[model samples]
Target chain A: MIGRLNHVAIAVPDLDEGIRLYRDVLGAHVSEPQDEPDHGVRVVFVELPNTKIELLYPLGENSPIRSFLEKNTAGGIHHVCYEVEDILAARDRLIAQGARILGTGEPKNGAHGKPVLFLHPKDFNGTLVELEQI
Target chain B: MIGRLNHVAIAVPDLDEGIRLYRDVLGAHVSEPQDEPDHGVRVVFVELPNTKIELLYPLGENSPIRSFLEKNTAGGIHHVCYEVEDILAARDRLIAQGARILGTGEPKNGAHGKPVLFLHPKDFNGTLVELEQI
Candidate 1:
């Protein structure tokens, strides 16, 4: 089962502009961009009181969010990650309930170095959901 | 300045189905549907630990999110509401920074009976942002 709302990831076309918007305009404490080559994206954390807003930018040509950025050139919310206690149990339960797991149904190391699994958007009311094991 | 993320509103085509998915499948504590005619939408709140996930459905003929539900069919993230200490001050500061406020540029009574203002998505990295005065 989902534990906590981890972070909402927004794929931005321009990373600096996104940072400036959140930092200068929104007046939020923002972290410097960290490159995650394994995840194929650059991420900045906008730390709020209760949760985080992750600003995501494509790192390379093969970045997974590249197409999403292309479609929404100004940037848009890409997905929301929820913290889970036991990922494999959660995955199995979701699978038993006829939910579809994306990307070979295997847990991948997320940007936070935690095991994560993505559920199919269609099964989740068109919202792409990521489950991060905490 | 923004404080906690109040809730992320997801516009769903079917409110009942959305409730089932979150409550039955994802296993979150979902509230009963509450109709807000003033806001032109009915909402169900999924109470997570830190924040809430609001599932929205069109209420009547002039429902604001009717077109969005039609476009997304399955459902999609409509907007994210962030809490602010003083909304008028926040609005004025956002305007000074060249951020466009949606609608008549005045705070309206949001579904939760709080004064809320919506910023133009184009001005905010294509993410619809709502600022509710806490």
Candidate 2:
């Protein structure tokens, strides 16, 4: 089962602009940009009191975010992450309930250096749901 | 400034089905369905330990969720809501920083009976951002 709301990710065309918007304008504490090659994204975290905002930009032409941006042009909310106490348990429970997991159906290292898995958007009402181990 | 993440809203084609998925399958506590005529949608809240998930369905032909579902038949994430300590101050700050407020540029009563304002998706990397006064 989901534990807590981890973070909401937003895909942006430009990482610096997104950082500036959240930092200077929104007064959020933003971390240095980091390249998540495995995920094929350049990301930065905007820290909030109770949660964080992840700014994601495509790292390559084949990156999924690139295709999302191609259709949206302006980028958009990529996914919502929820924390779980146990990754395998959560995955099994979801699978038994007939939820499809993305990417080999195994947990991968997420931005926070924790195990994470993405659920099919169709199963989650059109929104991609990310489950991360706490 | 944003205080905390209040909830994530997902637009669903069927409200009852969505409730079943979260409540029966995911084992979440779900609130009774409520018709929010002002927002032109019927909604239910899935209670989580840290935050809530709002399932939205079109209430009428002109409802915005109707168009969203037309594009994404399976439904999807609608918007992200963040709590603000002061709605007016947050609006003024965001507006001053070039973020366009949606609707009438004034706070309106939101689902939880709190003042809320929406920021343009274009300004926040295409993610519709909702600010609610807590």
Candidate 3:
């Protein structure tokens, strides 16, 4: 099942603004922004003592974050990630229990360079949940 | 600023259904349901290795969660709570940095029996963030 709270992702309209809020204002250690073309996002990680916060911005026109931003003008909390020891086992268990996996039903390389899969928001009480292998 | 991820709150239409999904399906350890009249919401905690998941449901007609569910019939992620070392210090720092605290500027007793304050969604890139003093 789920292991740790890997990171909470917040989609921001402007990556620079998001960085300023967390870095300059909040005074948190933030990583360099990296383009995740596969996920259609530009991401930066704000490291914390026990968990991390991921700042996400749209990378391409068809980016899902862009659509989310359109619905929410200021952008918002996009997803919460939970770590799992075994990705396939967790996926199978969740599937057996009638949870819908997003995309191709296969794990992909996530922002942390680990295998990850996204569960449909409808199945998770309208919150997009990401399961990452750690 | 932020110490750890306290919990991710998800507003659900039905508390029982939410529990079933996380407990029975996800195989997570869930706490007993508790009605928080002060917040006008019923809450339950799903314990994980790293962080907890809070399942929230409207306790009364006037509950804010009720309004959220009206828009999202399927229920969804409500807010993310981050732990802080000192609530007052965190509040002062954030306020000085132009972050608006939700409700009153003062902190209130949170679910985990800690002083907590909520930041406006607009300031945090549309994420309703909760900062709890640990």
How does each model score on lDDT?
0.93, 0.87, 0.88
| Winning model by TM-score | 1
After superposition, the stretches of candidate 2 with alpha carbons farther than 4 Å from their true spots are none
Q: Per-residue alpha-carbon lDDT of model 2 for B5-101, expressed as tens digits? A: 8888999988888998888766778999999888889999988887888999999778877888898899888898988899999999998888899
In Å, residue A72's CA in model 2 sits off its true spot by: 1.8
Q: CAPRI verdict on model 2?
A: medium
**Candidate 2 vs. true structure, TM-score:** 0.93
Candidate ranking (lDDT, best to worst): 1, 3, 2
In candidate 1, stretches whose alpha carbon ends up further than 4 angstroms from where it belongs are none
DockQ per candidate, 2 decimals: 0.87, 0.73, 0.80
- Between prediction 1 and prediction 2, the one with superior TM-score is 1
Score residue B82 of candidate 3 by CA lDDT. Answer: 81
Comparing candidate 1 with candidate 3, which one achieves the higher lDDT?
A: 1
Q: Is the docking of candidate 3 incorrect, acceptable, medium or high quality?
A: medium
Q: Which lDDT tens digits does candidate 3 get at residues B14-114?
A: 78989998888777899999998888899999998888899999987788778888988998888988888889999999988888998879999987778
Residue B54 lDDT (model 2): 92
Once fitted onto the true fold, the runs of candidate 3 whose alpha carbons sit more than 4 angstroms away are: none
**Which residue pairs show collisions in model 1?**
none
Q: Highest DockQ: give the candidate number.
A: 1
Clashes of 2: 4
Least well predicted 10-residue stretch by lDDT in candidate 2 chain A: A1-10
The DockQ-based order of candidates, best leading, equals 1, 3, 2
User: What C-alpha RMSD does candidate 3 show over the true interface residues after superposing them?
Assistant: 1.2
